[model samples]
Target: MAKEIPQILKGFRDYLPQEQLARKKIMQKISEVFERFGFAPMDTPALEYYELLGGKYGEEGEQLMYKFEDQGGRKVAMRYDLTVPMARFVASYPELPKPFKRYQMAPVWRADKPQKGRYREFMQCDVDIIGSDSIIADAEVIATFDAAFKSLEIGEVKVKFNDRKLVDQVLTKLNIVKKDIGNFMRTLDKLDKIGEEKVVESLVEQGFDRNILKKYSQLMEKSSKGYVNQMTQLLSGLGVEQMEFDKYLMRGLVYYTGIVFEFVLVAKPEFGSVCGGGRYDDLLEKTTGVKMPAVGGSIGLDRLFAAIQEMDVVAPQTAAEVIVFNLDENLTADYLNMTTNLRNAGIDAEVVYEPSKLDKQFKYAQAKNMQVAVIFGPDEASARKVTLKNLREKEQRTVDLANLVAEVKSMLW
Candidate 1:
């Protein structure tokens, strides 16, 4: 038999419990916020027909799609993002209510070279509202994310946004032809990465006059004030405090037709935008042949997780809150009963199946970050009591088995 390979492909990962729990915690917080705004849960296939996803993401995005022919000789590709597949979904099911609001948390793939906080495969926590073009819809999306981050205790973030319409206006005023607006926006999106001088140089190389490039840059610097004031008032009314209007936030997606926003971690700006999305009014019409306005945002979950880790936000090492040590093989039944009672009382409890040494069991509890450890020796079992130890406080107390649930609950709380 051939030796099996023991490695995962580049840009992919296997999430063990510790990492997965943190991600899930973040996702749960995000989902709660999404649902609070009346967004319903949704799911879509990981793979879609190539034609369905093709041409939606612009030239660079197309190149980064993980595309291949399937076993049936059909061209298929892993979804690049949740939004495109969402467009297909709305088109396929016209029966879906107008102003459809949905939240989808799933993995997306990209073939782009992986870098810090960037990956070939990662989870996107997305929430979208379709069939609504109102600015209120945009504000609601922003507010939901603001609430999610606050809930996650990820510290402060600024929701920086810009209007694509304003960018278009600047382009028109600068005599940038319609044929080149897409390329111009794509170039402008790199302003933060390459700096203003390099952006101007790149545009000049693309045949834009030096004077026009300078004029465009000047206009970009000034055009965002009025829009910023308007959005600031709107978002403030919704309790979203930190927002800024950045004229250069031209999100790279060609589909965006209106306001686009990105969440920037104030504490760690080098991690880049942890979340971003924009309005894509023409995309649904383009994909489904039915014109409907839509706007959305996605939290780059892996990146956000990395940021949390970098910030030293402590996450629980294990889901189990209470570990019941099997101190004696003969006392297995007692241990199981105690664990069962704790679980029945809505506490997450685990019991050692095999008898283990006292020190080893305590070490396991500590390693797992278990809050409480219950030991049921023959003495305690005979007395119908258990020794409950608080791993965090390093204290122990004897509680009657009848009151063990309440005692553990109190300690955990």
Candidate 2:
């Protein structure tokens, strides 16, 4: 028999306990903010019929999908984003109320080359409000994202937003033909990545008139500022702050029909957008033949988590708060009982299953980052008392068994 390989595929990863716990903490903070804004929790399958998801994302986006044929010989693709699946969901269930709002935290796959923060499989935390075309919905989505970042305590972030309609207007004013609009907008989206000179060069190479390109550039600068001012005032009125109007932000997704936005770290602009989304008013109608206006955004959990770690944000090292050490095999019952009492009191406690040397147990507790270690030796067992040691502060106290829970709680906090 051949020895099996013990390696994970490239662009995929396994989260250790420490990383997983930190990820959970971030997700919890996001989920709390979503619920506070009245978005209900929901989920959709990771796989969908290929035709259902095809062409929803633009040409480049479709190329990045993890597509294949199932064993049953049916074409399928892993979902690229939650929004499109959500549109299909709304269409499938007509009885859902208008302006339906939902929050989903799930993994999506993209077959793109892996980089620092880019992964083939990553988690997206999404919140969407459907069946409403009002800018108020857009404001609420932005505001919800603001609340989430504030809660997470990530440093200052700037929300750069623009309306696709404004881009359309600019193209029309430039006499850009309708057939070239998609290519033009896509090129415009790359302005930040490639400099202005390169963008112009690319557009000119695509046969756009240099004179018209220059005109379009100048007009966009002026119009973008005007639109930014209007949006800033509107968002301020809705209690959202720090919005910058970006004329060049053409979110690469083809479905976005209006107002698109992205969140970038103020301290690390090169890290790219940590969160982004926009209005897709025609998506539901296009996919399910039902008209439903929608606007939403997604926080790339993997990227955001990486950013938080890079910023030196402190995270808890262990899930267990206290570990009850086993001093002797004979004291196993006592150790189990004490751990149970602590757990029943709403504390996360663990007991050593196999009696081990005191040094080994202490080392284990330290490795797990446990806050407190409860010593249950024969002396303490006979006295019906426990000696609690603060692993971090290196302090120890002997307490009556009756006060064990209280003593641990005081030390943990």
Candidate 3:
């Protein structure tokens, strides 16, 4: 028999302890912002029936979806994004309250070719407002995006936005036929990536006249000024100052019916948009046979974390705050009791399973980036006291067993 080598599929990855901890912290911060804005947490499965997911995404998205028949011979597909599944969720539960506000943090799969920040499987932090068609709803979603980045302290971020209605007006002005509008918009979205010359070439290849595309290129600069001014005034009260209009921000989703916005790190524009989403009023109506309006946005968590690493954001190496050292095997039960007491007082405490050399235990605590260590040697036990060692400061002090929790708390905080 041959031994197998460990492997993982391409475009997927396993996050080590430090990276996962940072990612969780990022999610928690974003979730907190969402809840503060009155959005509640909810979730959907990673897989949905093919019929439910297929054709919802535009052509490009359809190609990138992980779809196949299941063992039961039922067509199933991994969710490519959270927005579509949210539409399905709303349609399934018709009795859900009006103006639903939700936040979901979960993994979504895409069969896309992996790149520096792009991955086949990644977590998305999403928030949506359903049932209201007010412009305030759109502004609220954008404001939430701004708040999330502010909470993360990821430096300056600009939430660029443009309305599909405005894009439609531009397309109509360019004499682009209704049938070609969607394809034209999708191609227009590539302008920032491929540049205007190539976008013109692409649209020309798609049978648009050269002169019209050239005119379209020239009109782009002036097209967004008015809308940008309008949105800035609307978003004034929300404390969202880092926003502007991007004529090229035609998010490639087909369901978007109104405004679309993207969050980009101002200091690192080349890092691309770490989050993007828009309004989709008709998404649920087609399934539930009722008028439903929704607007949502998602943070590309993996890509955001990658940017965070590159930007040198401080992150903890371990979640454990303190480790209880195992000194004497006979006193293991006492160490366990102290660990429990720390935990009961809302501290993150860990105890070594077996008695180990003091040097080895000290090294373990240091390697885990623990702030403090609790040592209960026979001498301290006999004295009814415990030694609290500040790992980083290389300081130690003796405290009564009754004061263990307070002493550790002071050391950590």
Candidate 4:
């Protein structure tokens, strides 16, 4: 017979109930932050036409997307990010309110090599503001991200910002054609990953003149705003200025024209930006053929989770507040009724369903981390009373049924 199949995939693992509880708490906190900032929730289909998602993400992103022919023989792919799909959403539904602030939390698929903190399929917590290009939007996005990380109880995170126009001015001065800009920016994007020396080598390998490397290297080294202006001004020598700080940002797509930004964890520098976004002025024209400027950002939930785990900042597991101990077989129904009443009162109570000895029952309650255990013994049930046991304090009280609500309320309150 064939060997038994494993329960999980290579890059994916099953989330146990305790882990799921933690995840829900984390998500709830994030959602609250987003809502407080006036961002509402929205969702779109996970699958999109292959062509729809193709040119939005850059060369590397397109490669990682999971694409295949559907049953109807239509080429489709799981969305790789919320931004691209939102672009399509705006284009398809032109009537959407202007400057819409939306938050989307969903899973996306990618076919990529999995590592310690990287996975092929992962979730993204995205917040986007469409139909505006004001610097205020850009600044607010960064500020909101700052608040979000704090709300998550994660450590300090920095938002690295740059302009696409600067890169463009440098390339234009070098006499590179418009067609080569994509290739050039793609190479520049790897500067963080490959380092200056390797990136220069790759640029040369990509058929760029070696002499052009010196000026770029000098500019890249002097990336500070002051140095950048000096290089562009001195190098251009043109009567009119070009490649202002706002212009030379890293443009991943044609839609993004200004103010690209990313969020990085202070503790894990090499893990890459866990959340990033930028302004896109031309995405509106894709469908409506009308220019509408927009800005947005995405949180890499998977990467953030791993980094937080490494930093030992995960939420503790505590599901049940009170467990109804199971000692007498006949009193099981009584315990169930007690737990049910507790539940109706908005208390987290669970009836221990299994038959066990008295000591074992108490041990089970303790093991489950229950703070309190309600006992419905025959005597207590017959007398129309309940025994409330506070295991942590090693105390017990027999409360009359008339005061049951008040008794439980006092402890819970």
**Which model is ahead, 1 or 3, in terms of TM-score?**
1
- Worst lDDT 10-window in candidate 1: 208-217
* Model 1: colliding residue pairs: none
> What is the full ranking by lDDT, best candidate first?
2, 1, 3, 4
lDDT of 4: 0.74
Candidate 1 regions exceeding 4 Å error are 1-5, 221-225
TM for candidate 3 is 0.95
In model 1, what is the error at residue 85, expressed in angstroms? 0.6
Better of 1 and 4 by TM-score: 1
Residue 194 local lDDT, model 2: 93
Clashes of each: 0, 0, 0, 10
| Estimated TM-score for each candidate | 0.96, 0.96, 0.95, 0.84
Per-residue CA lDDT of candidate 3, range 1-413, in tens?
99998899999999988888888888888999999999998899998898888888889889999999999999999988998888878877878897999999999999998987889999999999999998899999999889999999979999889899877777788878889988888888888899988988898899988776667656766786776777798787898988878777889889898999998988778879899999999988764566799999999999888888888874676888999999888997898899899999999989999987999998888888898989888899889998898988999999999999988989888
Q: What is the lDDT of residue 83 in candidate 2?
A: 90
Q: State the lDDT at 288 in candidate 2.
A: 91
lDDT per residue (tens digit) for residues 248-358 in model 4? 237465567766777778888777778888777776676346667888888888788778878888855558878887767887777777778888988888887876777
Stretches of candidate 3 exceeding 4 Å from the true structure: 217-226
User: What C-alpha root-mean-square deviation, in Å, does candidate 3 show against the real structure?
Assistant: 1.9
